[model samples]
Target: MALRVAAELRRGQVVNLGIGLPTLVANYTPPDAGVIFHSENGILGYGPHAAEGEEDLDLINARGEHVTLPPGGAVVSHTDAFAMVRSGRLDVAVLGALQVSEKGDLANWMTPEKGIGSPGGALDMAAGAKRLIVITEHTNGGAPKVLKECSYPLTAAGRVDLIVTDLAVMEVTGDGLLLKEVAPGWSVESVRGLTGAPLRVSDGLKEMDFTLPQHPPVNKVYPSAAEAVADVPDGAVMLMDGFGGLGGMPHYLMLALRDQGAKGLTVVSNTVGIARVSGFGTPPSPDLQAVDHSILVERGQIRKAIATFPVSPSPSRPSAFERAYRRGEVELEVVSQGTLAERLRAGGSGVAAFYTPTGVGTVVAEGKEVREFNGRQHLLEEAIRGDFAFVRAHKADTLGNLVYRGTSRNFNLVMAAAAAVTIAEVDEIVEPGVLDPEAIVTPGIHVRRVVQRPAVFSPFQPIKPIEDNGRG
Candidate 1:
């Protein structure tokens, strides 16, 4: 059944395989198929399941089983992973279903009147994927799982595109359930007998093909953050990976760059930094600890910045980068968030430039060539590249294969690919074989160095409270 479903996958499609039998599709995928597997736990480009002792406890799929990662695979934050689903970036989503209606409604997350269930990412994937394919048994205990109307709560209304059961292959069309094929030896009447919904056989019904295709994991680790940034010279363009402040910003690496005193640097990032504030409570002292690129700007390391948000909104509490720009000490080039991501992706993928309508009719279109496409104007935006990128991850093997945790993976994944030299600051370092091959988000080929963060740098540490400076 898994092989049959896998055979339906086309090359260069981004697919998300649900738990159970759907997960087996990864194993049957041909090495040259170019199907990128996405796991809701925040990994893309994952390979097949691991065998025996090859499992890495820290590396697992959404099903919590060990898996392998492909060469150009990436890991992202949970939010970003779902963003890819909700934004219709996923080509196909193969899921298991409890019940499916003739109108293509899906009901797999939960049962009717039973509040006990985990929806996980089913609703998002079902509604957002370009194609939703359900793979399940034809019957459960002699009861048909397909139905005229789903008895269970709907995962998404009228979203299923295809349904592959153990007994038949069906497509959900506007007309109704169109039976395209059946399992070998099973008569059309036999499949119709098992289906609860009205089944119309295709005129050219054929046997479902299940021919299996034969299928077919670096280092870079650095010692300290200081040593990792030691080679970054002055006036070099650097890609700083982070979203907000807590999302995998290379905090220690930024501190090291401040100490390294590399002057006149160009930095590209989502934000420059937040403002400093005094510590709260008993001590009532100024909180001088720097967590983002603000420290670099404070030390006059950044001569220019290309980013979406360069300063905090409040004028009275300007960020360090803002202060420097106001004083004619730094250059700023603002860009739309979407364009920034595309630019970096293009840079890493070796695409020169692309046009988009995002910044049309705005100041962002200044000096850039505009092209008309389908009666709309789009500005040509060049790709962004960097000499070095400072990234953070949860775990890395000796070969610089990295796995990120939770929301920390945001921009780190993309920046790793866009930089000439990618330096990763991770919490833990393991042996090369200790990591599950499928769990690695950043392949070592993209990473030039890996630095392990000190054990004391806890991700969950409370933000320093600002001291009241009498104004409050």
Candidate 2:
């Protein structure tokens, strides 16, 4: 049915599809068909639905799923969007129907069973478009919908040009409803048995084709980390993943973010900043401008930090974030290490919040809901999602599939899936099928952009175990 609807759309046509069933048409429209989809929400030529777990809260369709704009797509204001509708720019408007009459009357706004109805842009599209096509079921709960007169409230009278249903396809003419084609296994006599209006069977009537079509694959590679995070705005919640200092840190991306200068950021990380010890972790790169999230804090770009460890293990060597906090320069939300990882995982999985016993009885239980499971009290921890994720990986395919080495996999894998845009900096960029499928830590669907880290900097190496001397 979706293929049949897509066949009606011509190349270079601007189309508006109503909510619900009409939205499915966009999914099935062939990528090369050149049909531009315009949404009442103000985006024209938006790309397909976002890959799961990579939903950007800001860019969305009417259904509230995150989306993107094509290379030539335009994002207009709400007023300008309505202008496109009312100014006769739309060539076709395909909508779902509650009931359509023989005389081309459309009743799709509401039914008698429901009191409230949304007239959102449907009224405008119906009244303004050159052609209107209705897609719906033949019957509403086993009742006829192609009626002599519609029983539901009318959206537009004498406007519907075509109707496609589960039973048959009909064209509205000045005389009556003309049956152009019938669904498979459905005959003219059986269709007439279900219609309230008289049917005029076409001399060349045929069967509707239900062949499925394939959706196009998208390429998600960006040239540089700066360009990858170029669109990130101020006041964005960012997830930065690293453990044991620079081993798994997104060093170059953080440097790019600091240079990008988007202020008032709320960074969510396992640790607020990277801490270097005399003989542990990876040594800092001298040529690099900054090494960790502390660079952003030192530059005063971050407004708040939600972290598991905000201070260094060594009391004498305070990190930049601890200094900022001590001076009342930035806000902090302290979360337990386990709870923080779970929160990020939950956030990406669409869970709002969960209860945990890690922070219970401490200050973390202050204003949160405390639930008793059995006898122990648990504190509710809200999920931690972000606008952008800065991830470090050993390698990435052009499609953004990431593979990590050793400890680099910590937090990096989960953080990649927990943000709207996961910008990855990797040591190498390989083509598809070059990396082992089983070695893929995070699939390409969850990543938005991938940039190759320069070879000048070395990969993080782990500290070797110290041997004991028997001098004591």
Candidate 3:
């Protein structure tokens, strides 16, 4: 199967090898091949397997387990990693799968069999990449892994473009699956017979010309505080910013950290919402309890959360109920929105404390110093810091200047400027000196990495005219 699979590798491709099956590709990438491997945890260079005591403690791939960085390899935060993927900086993303439908839909995130099927980075990779290459076993339990159609749950709707199995290589097309190449000893029909699902054939099905994936370093365009804290040792305090999915790339990077199983993360954000898009213009009221990645952290899966605010979900959803049931483990400390913003700002400004009336008489005042000024009481909140900050903006110029769009500007701009390392994810990457200087929101000084994501999903929230209220 390795021999059959190695042929699909092409030199100079930025590749994402999936966790289980796809990770194997890292071991197989040819030494002479120049393909760069991107781990979601923010590493961009990889070398062959290491000899004893040769591996650097800092070099690691997206999965967060220790890995070796090839010569000229660099490390950034997960926010920077996804920036590369979303910006179309990568040539190919090799993902693993539970099933591949005739229509090329991938259902690898969760099987009915697995308890917690966090889609994690798969959703981002599937939707953001220009080309997605999935590598998986032909079948699970003698049932074909390829299917007439996916009966399991879908991770991203209709995203996969190519599939390489032990027996053959097939491409997804608008009409159906197209058989592109077959192993030397395997017949198309033989490959089809072993597949538990229906198969499609292309008019030009043939053997793939074997080659290694390519890797070429595009110059770094964005510079941020990441360079400032590059010397921070691994396993130090790391804080990220995002109100979960809608906010920006921070949550994406947080998931990458969770996957890496990196401990001692002192996450300080407004709120950790559900895995997918939970809140964004649902009327800023705080009744929503999003099922954040903290769900994993609370179960002793990761470390404890040291920030304020509990998961607030929207009305009438089962996930909200599940979150409530698990509230005991969450150990949340709720804070007012204004206070959260100020606290983060203070952290970035290197301020020890800030006075705010937002949480004065409420439960939020349980701990800390309280003082009366002009007959009004105020509680003091301390500053916070982390090894990194994952942020996404709408656009970036070649010099790493950034501009955010609409509600996308929320928490993102502040977090972008606040973190030790700010990674910007933009939908478009233009040449230097192109954007109007006035339109630039976050200056190039705050942004460390700028990657353009052409097809990053920004759903249209149709604006409706407000009907007249009785008060009006």
lDDT of each: 0.79, 0.78, 0.61
Q: Which parts of model 2 have CA positions greater than 4 angstroms off? A: 5-217, 277-290, 458-472
Model 1 C-alpha lDDT per residue in residues 170-242, reported as the tens digit of each score: 9999989999989999999999999999998999898887865443312256668888898888899999958
The digit string of per-residue lDDT tens for model 3 on 1-472 reads: 4444455666545677777777777677675665667778766556665666876566656565567654434455677566556544556777888888877788888878776687888877887666888888777777888887788888766788878887788888887777878877888889988875556777787875566445564344533323423343434554454554445544334433433444444555555544323444243334432335443353333234544434445545333213633665434455677777766666654455887777777888887789887889888887555556666677776546677777777667656656656666567778655665435666554555664543543222222232322210
> Which has the greatest TM-score?
2
Q: In candidate 1, which residue ranges exceed 4 Å CA deviation?
A: 1-219, 275-287, 458-472
- Poorest stretch of ten by lDDT in candidate 1: 277-286
Q: List the residue pairs that clash in candidate 2.
A: none
Worst 10 residues of 2 by lDDT: 463-472
Tens digit per residue, CA lDDT, model 2, 5-70: 877887656788887788888888865666767777866667788889877786787667688654
For residue 203, model 2's alpha carbon misses the true position, in angstroms, by 28
Instruction: For each candidate in turn, give its C-alpha RMSD to the true structure in angstroms.
Output: 15.1, 15.4, 19.1
- Compare candidates 1 and 2 on TM-score and give the better one: 2
- Model 3: how far is 30 from its true place, Å? 2.6
